[model samples]
Target: MKFNATLLAQFFHFILLLIFLRIVAYKPVANMLKSRQEFITNNVAAAEEDRKQAEALRQQYLADMQKAREEAQAIIQQATKAGEVQAQEIIEAAKTEANRVKDNALQEIAREKEKAVAELRDQVASLSVLVAGKIINQTITPEIQHGLVQDFIKEAGDLPC
Candidate 1:
């Protein structure tokens, strides 16, 4: 091996360059990479926490919807029951009114029938009295009047005097 000053100086210069690059560029680049890795890890963890919170909120919304639906169904059922009750009440009231009207009509018919019968009886009595007076004036004898009266009575059947 031949010792050359120029070769040694070149070698030494290359070592100094490597040391300077390590101190100035390599360390700074390595620190920057480490910091970037930490930032990425923290961001990933925060994103995972936010995803969990969103999932919880979604579940809560679904539960609230279910409760609202149940309440609406209950209200509908109550309204249906109330409507049925009202309908039944209306039907009962109508039936009662109809029965009352029918009873009133029957009573009115009975009163009319009785009034007609009384009027017919009054006319019959008047006609019978007029006939009796005529017979009394024409016969003028007690025996004939008595016999005619008996015959009239027999022919008239059960009519009142």
Candidate 2:
């Protein structure tokens, strides 16, 4: 092949154009691409960290809800137990009061019965004294004695004497 000056000059021009383009466009574009890649990597890492934090918060919230439920259940159980105890105490107090009232009523009935018996005895004694006075004032006959005894029985059986 012959040494062509025109071919050599074209090759030199092509080399100079490549050098200029590399300095002006290629390096800047490569650096921009590298910076963009770094930015994307940093953003992806930050997004992953945020996702992890959100997951942790969700777990904590679930745990807190469970704990709250447990506490509420415990409080309800405690209240139920207290109510049962109070109900039992009320029943016991009512029973005690009823028993006391029953005893008091029985005692009152006994006292009334005793008072009635004493009043009956007093009436009997007064009627016996009155009969004795009539017998002393009258002639003693079988029919008169029987009639007086019957009259005494009638007065004793009737009330408001």
Query: TM-score: which candidate is best?
Result: 2
* RMSD, every candidate, angstroms: 6.2, 3.7
Angstrom error of the Cα, residue 69, model 1: value is: 1.4
Q: Estimate each model's TM-score.
A: 0.69, 0.79
- Residue range 134-157, candidate 1, lDDT tens digits: 786885588877877776666566
Reference-based TM-score, model 1:
0.69
- Candidate 2: C-alpha lDDT: 0.95
Query: Global lDDT of each model?
Result: 0.88, 0.95
Candidate 2 structure, TM-score to reference: 0.79
Looking at candidate 1, the ten consecutive residues that score lowest on lDDT are 152-161
Clashes in model 2: which pairs?
none
